[model samples]
Target: MPAIEVTSLSKTFRTKRKAAGLGASLRSLVRPEFRTIEAVRGLSFEMEPGELLGFIGPNGAGKSTTIKILTGILFPSGGEAKVLGYVPWKQRRQLAYHIGTVFGQRPQLWYHLPAIDTLTLFGKIYELDDRQTKRRIAELAEAFEIEDLLETPVRKLSLGQRMRCEVAASLLHKPKLLLLDEPSIGLDVVAKQHIRDAIRTMAAQENVGVLLTSHDAGDLEALCKRVIIINHGQIVYQDKVSALKRSFLTSKLVEVRYAQQVGADFRIAGTETLKVAKERYGVKLRFDARITPVGKVMAALSAAGTLVDITISDPPLEEVIAAIYQKAENRE
Candidate 1:
């Protein structure tokens, strides 16, 4: 059976509308208008056991709403979902033992207490034996590099440190499935890598399925095998991460540094020069690999001057996702 089975899953929220100005507000209070927001609509998907799935979108794209519904934290307006073979909203209490979650914007750690205190409390809440709980804590501390931070007060820890602790807390139960919403938010480059690596290791070791949502493209590239892109409360694209890259990650960003100064108007054929260093020794460029082979660009740069450094990368994940949204909107 699939780790997560969501069929026609949907959630709609009704918000009371208030007009501007005191008079209008007063009248609205007497007869309030409500706006119906379709946070999730007709969503259908399934995640296999031990699968790493990326569910990503822009702000207000219903990523968080879908996660919450699957976790049984909110009632969906319509449709249904089963998490680990249990109906989410109907069997939430029973299903709680099998899943872990981390919401980036919400704090699960105690503000005034050290993170260890919260972790220990979770051990009890999850019914973990004291001996096993200690062992798990030790393992997670090493994996997350939080042995030192665990003792510091959560309020005293930096956002990155606290986030490491928060994710560790979620894994205290050694859940079979993880639902992470923006797990890498507020994390720096190195910190983000640490979290991704740790999560990947833990998932592999335990055969845990992961459903992750993040704005950072690096997270998806690093952690997920498959990705589902959502927009306006619906799925716009779903495919293997490699396939998504092959289709939309066509352009490459190349930055190169030379050992000596070059002409200010330096340009390459079939490539766009995004920037040239003020020192005249370095240049930033972009090109479609399909048009100008990567080997050609490298050869041209090599022949120009003694190479000092070079960097090549794909366009941002946001750019690729935006293209998807545009294509979907045009079709609609």
Candidate 2:
């Protein structure tokens, strides 16, 4: 069975609108105007057990709202949803036992207290016994490389250190599912890689299904097998990461080296020459595989000279996401 099933989920928020003038504000207090914002709209999707799913979107795209709804933090206006065979809104407490969550902007740890203290508190909340909690903390400390930081006050720890603690705390009970919303938001490249590696290791060890939402495309590429892209509170694209790349990540960067020096002008038909080596034996270029097939490009390159070395790589995922959003906007 799917670990998560969300069908026709929707959330609407109402905010009181105020006018410019003081008199208008006073009058609005008596008869206030309200603006209805559709944060999520008829969203439908499923996640299999032990799958890493990426839920991504621009700011205000309802990614957070959908995650909150799934985790039972915010009740949706209309929808039927089941997470781990339990309806999240109707069975929040029961579902909490089987799921973990991390929200980037919110700190779950005590500010002045050590991270270990917060972990202890969570252990109690999850009903873990003292020995079990200690063992789990030790294991997580090793996995996340936070054994030395656990006793340090959360406020004293750096962003990366604290984030590692936050994730470790969420896994204290070994939940079957984890929902991470921008857990690596403020982390540096090295720190981000550290957290990603730990998460990958733990997910593989425990078979935990992860539903991650992040602005960082690198996170999606590194952690998720499938991706769901949403914009303006609705899904625009949902597919396997490789399929998304093949479909929209059309552009490719090619670096080629010939056995000997070729002419100064190193160019190829249907491909844009980005740069040529000063000695003129190597060239770098780009092309859309959709327009000029890989086979054709390779054949053309071989025809130019004896191939010594060649590397072909796709454009960055950020570009693919941007292109998808722009295409959606153009359609609108």
lDDT tens readout by residue for model 1, 119-168: 99999999999999999999999988999888889999988888889989
Please state the error at residue 138 of candidate 2 in Å. 0.8
The global C-alpha lDDT for each of the candidates, from Candidate 1 onward, is 0.92, 0.94
* Root-mean-square deviation (CA) per prediction: 2.3, 2.7
TM-score of each: 0.90, 0.90
Candidate 1, which segments miss by more than 4 Å at Cα?
Answer: 256-267, 276-281, 297-310
Clashing pairs in 1: none
For candidate 2, the clash count comes to 0
Evaluate model 2: give its TM-score. Answer: 0.90
Show the colliding residue pairs in model 2. Answer: none
